[model samples]
Target chain A: MALIEVEKHEVEEEQKPEPVRVRGLPFFPHFLLREVVVMCLIAGGLIMLASIYPAGLLKPADPFDTPSPIYPEWYFLYVFGFLKFWTWDLGPIPAKMIGVTVPMVLWYGLLILVPFIDRNPSSDIRKRKVAVTLGVIVLIGILYFTYFSIVHH
Target chain B: MTLNDKIYKWLDDRFKLSELLPPIVKHPAPLNVVSNPLYCLGGTAFLCFLILVITGIFLAMYYKPTPAEAYKSVEHIMTAVPMGSLIRSVHHWAANTMIAAVMLHMMRIYFMGAYKKPRELNWVVGISLLLITTTFGFSGYLLPWDQLAFWATKIGTGIAGSIPVIGGYISLILVGGNDIGAETLTRFFAIHVMILPIAIATLLGLHFMMVRIQGISGRL
Candidate 1:
C-alpha cells in the first residue's frame, strides 16, 4: 500500500509542467539591434553583388524566330520536369489532367491537410517519424526533379 | 527640458504617439525565438520584399509596357541611366532571395510543427502567400519582353492552355489574347505592379496580425 502511494506521487510529479524560462533581453533594443545589423550586412552583400555582376539584357523578342527548348524560371523547373516525365501515349485532355492538374492539386492538398492529418500534439521531430519522413522525401524528390530538368534541358 | 524631450512632448500631444507606440515597440518575443536564427527568415523575406518594391518603383519610372519599347527601355535603363543596371540587378537578386526566404520560412514552420491547432489558418494564408509570390515572379518575368521572357511565357501559358475544358480560357485570360504580344505585356505589367502588390500587402498584414495575436508557437 505504501509503495503504491509512492508510485502515484511520482507519476503526479512527472506530470507537472516545468517552469517557463524567460531568457531573452527586451525587444526594443536587443532584438531590433540584431535585426538592424543583419539587415545592414544583407544590404552590403547585395550592393557588392549588384556592382560585380549586373543583370544582362537579352535581345528583343521575335515571334517569327522561336527559341529551341524554351524553359521557365528555375523555380518552375520541377513542374517542367513533371510535364516531361509523364509523357505517355495518354490523350491531350487525360495527359493534362493527370500530369499537370492532379499532381499540382495533390501537392497543395497535402500542404493544406498537414495540420489536420498529423494530430499528434508533440513538436519533437523524432516523435513524428511519419511526418518528418514524408517531408524529407518530398524535399528530395523536388530537388532531384529540379536537377534533372536543368541538366536534361 | 532637453531638446529631444520637448520635441517628443510636442508630437505626443498632437498625435497621441506615446499612447499608440508602446504596445508595438515593446512587444515581447519568446526567448527561444530570439535565440534561434531560423525564426528570422520571415523577417528577411519581408526585408527583401521592401527592397524589391523600392527598386521596382525606380525601374517602373523608366520601363515601358508596350511590346515595341519594352526591351529598348530595359536596355536604356542599363546603359544610359545612372546606376540603373545595379538597381535592376538588385531587384532581380532580391526577388530570388525573397522567394528562397519564404520557402525556408515555410519549411521551418513545418518542421517545428507550428501550424497545428489554432495556427492552421495562418498556414493556409502562408501557402496562399507563397502562390501569390510565385505569381508575382511569373508576371514580372514577361516585363522585359526579351527573347527568354517571350518564349518562357509562351511555354508557361501553353501549359495553362493544356488544361482540359477551361484551359483555353485560362490561357486567354493570362495572355490577354491568343498569343503573347502587346496585350500580354500590358496585362502582366498591370498585375505585377498593381494587383499583386495590393493583394500581397493585405495578406501579409493578416498573417502578421495572426502571429501577433497567437504568439509564437512553443517548442516541444
Candidate 2:
C-alpha cells in the first residue's frame, strides 16, 4: 500500500507542468523606454504634419450663408450617415429622435453590455466567434457609412 | 548628507512625494501587453490630451469668447501671433489624434475581452470617458467660429434638440436660447475649457486607478 501511494505521488509530480516563463523586461526602464519612444514618435509626427500642412482658417461664420455641403468632422461622419439613411417618416416618433437615439443606444448598449454578453472565460479571438463577428461587422458598417457620407457630401 | 540627498530629504519632508510616487512609477506592467506596441493606445491618447491642454491654454490667452471677437481672435492667432499658427494647428491635430487613439484603445480592449468580469466598471468608465472626449471635440469645434464651426454646431445642437421629451430644453440650454448666438459661443467655450476638462480629468484618474488595481488584461 505504501509503495502504491509513493508511485501515485511520483506520477503526480511528473505530470506537473513547468512554470511559465513570461517574456518581457522590467517595468522601470524597459517598458518605460518603449513608452517614451512611442510618445516621441507621436510628437514628431504631429510636428511634421502641422508644419507641412498647417490647419486652415475657413471664412468667418455667417449664419446667413450656410456652406453647400456642410458636414461635421470625420469622427461624426458615422452618426451623420445614419441620420441621412434613416430619413423615413415616423408619425409619432420624431425622425431626428429615432435617427439619433437608436444608433446611440445600440452602439453604446453593445459597448456597455459587452462583458455580460460575452461570458466565456477565454480571451482568445478564435474561441470568441460571435463577439468577434459582431465587432467586425459594426466596425465595417461604421467605415462604410463614413465613406458613403464623405463621397455623397 | 550629500547635496542631492539633502535636497531630496528636504523636499520629501515638505511633500510626501517620495512615499507616494515610487510604487506607482515602478508598478510592473503585464509582460505580454507591454511587449506589444498596440497596447499603448490609451497612453498615447493621454499624451495627446496633454498636448491639447497645453496648446489650448496658449490659444486661450488670445481667444475671445464673444461671437464678435471669436473669429477675429482665431484669425489673429493664425496670421499674427508669432508661432500661433503652429500652436493652433497642433491643437487641432492633437484633438483629432486623441479621438482616434481613444477609439483604437477601446476597440483593442473590446477585442481582447479586457472588460470581462472584474473590469466591467472600468469599461463603463472608459465609455463615459469616450463620451466626454467626444463632447470635448464637439464643443471645441465651435470655438474657431468659422463657417464649418458655425453650421456644424447648428446641426449638432439640432440633433440634441431631437431628444424625445427634454430635447427642446436641452438644446435651449445648450444654445442658451432659440438660436446660436453670443450665448452659444460662450457656453461651448465654457464647456470645452472648463466643464469637460474637469469631468474628463476626474474620470481619467478613476480609469487609471482601476487599471492599476486590476493590472493590464492578458493578451489574446
Candidate 3:
C-alpha cells in the first residue's frame, strides 16, 4: 500500500537513481521465465507421477461418519477459535446481544467512523503513531487469541 | 476507451505514457481508482477473483455442488481429470490466499489512515466487503458436503442462531430446518453463487469510486 510512493519516490534498484541514458534500442526488462517454468514443471511432474500408478484410494463419505476436529480453514480459525473461547452462554437475549448482533453492529459501526476516530491526516508511518499502534495491537490480538485457541483447546 | 486499441498504441509509444496515463486517470474522478493504493489492492483482488472464477469454472466442469454428488465429483476431479489434483489444490490454495490478500488489503487501508477523511463511508463499505468475503468462504465450505462441510456450516449457522430475538428464525432460515439438508445446501449455494457475488460486486464498485475521489493517502 504505497510503501514507496510512485509519484515522488524514486524506488530505483539502488539507493540512488541511475541516470537513464536515452539509448533508443528497446531493452525489455528481464522476465523471470526460467524460475516460473521450473516451478510449473516440478508441479506438473509430481502430478503426472501420481497419475501413472494410482493408489485408487477414496472412501465413500458416509452421512453418519462425522469426523471430529471439524475446524475451518486456517483463515477462519481466528473466528472459529474466537467462537469457541467466547461463547456468550447467557441464554437467547444476552447471546444475541454479545455474539451475532452486537459484533456485527459494533464492527460496522466502528468502521463507519474510523476516519473520524483517528483524525490524523497522515498515512506516513512516522506521523501516524496512533493509527500504526492500533493496527499492530489489532493484528497481535487476532494472532494471539487465535494461537491461544489452538494451543489451549 | 477500448483497452486493446489503447494498449497496442501505448506499447508502440510508451515514452508518451505519462501524458496518456494522466489524461486517462483524470477521467471519471470518483469510482475510477487508478494510480492509487486502493487501485493496487483492487487490482490484486481482481487477479485473485480471476483465479477463483477460472479455477472454479474448471472445477465446476467436474464438481457436483450438492450433498450426495459433491464428494464424488471432487474425487473424480482429483483422480480422473488430467492434473486434476493439482488444479484442485491450486484452487484451494488460491481461495485461502485471496482471503488473506483481501484482509491484508483492508489492514493496509486501516493502518495507513486512508480510511479517514473523505473515505470514511468507503471504509465501512470495505468492512462489509470483508464480511461478505468470509461469508463466501463459509458457504463455500459446505459445497463439498463432506464431514468438514457438514459440521462447520452447522456451527457457522448455529452462530447465526445465537442472535437474541430472531436467532432461532435466522438459523431456521439459514439451515432451512432443524437440520442441515437439501434446503440448507441450496440456500448456501444461492449465497455463494448469486447473493454474495452481487453484493461484493456492488461494494467493489462503490469502493473503487470512493478511492478515486480520495486518491491515495501518503505514508508521511
Fnat of candidates, each listed: 0.62, 0.68, 0.34
Docking band of candidate 3: incorrect
Chain B TM-score per candidate, please. 0.95, 0.95, 0.79
> Highest DockQ, which number?
2
DockQ of 3: 0.22
DockQ of each: 0.36, 0.39, 0.22
lDDT of 1 at B35: 69
Error of 1 at B186 (Å): 0.4
The sequence of per-residue lDDT tens digits that candidate 1 reaches over residues B106-220 is: 9999988899888999999999898888889999898999998999999888887876678888898898878789999999999999999999999999999999999889974
**In model 2 chain B, where is the ten-residue run with the lowest total lDDT?**
B22-31
Clashing pairs in 3: A96-B164, A115-B116, A124-B219, A124-B220, B31-B209
lDDT for model 2 comes to 0.85
DockQ preference between candidates 2 and 3, better one = 2
DockQ-sorted candidate list, best first: 2, 1, 3
| Best-fitting candidate, scored by TM-score | 1
Interface RMSD, candidates in the order listed: 4.0, 3.8, 8.1
Cα error, candidate 1, residue A27 (Å): 1.5
Candidate number 1, chain A TM-score: 0.77
Give the distance in Å from residue A52's predicted Cα in candidate 2 to where it truly belongs. 1.3
- Worst-scoring 10-residue span by lDDT in model 3 chain B: B26-35
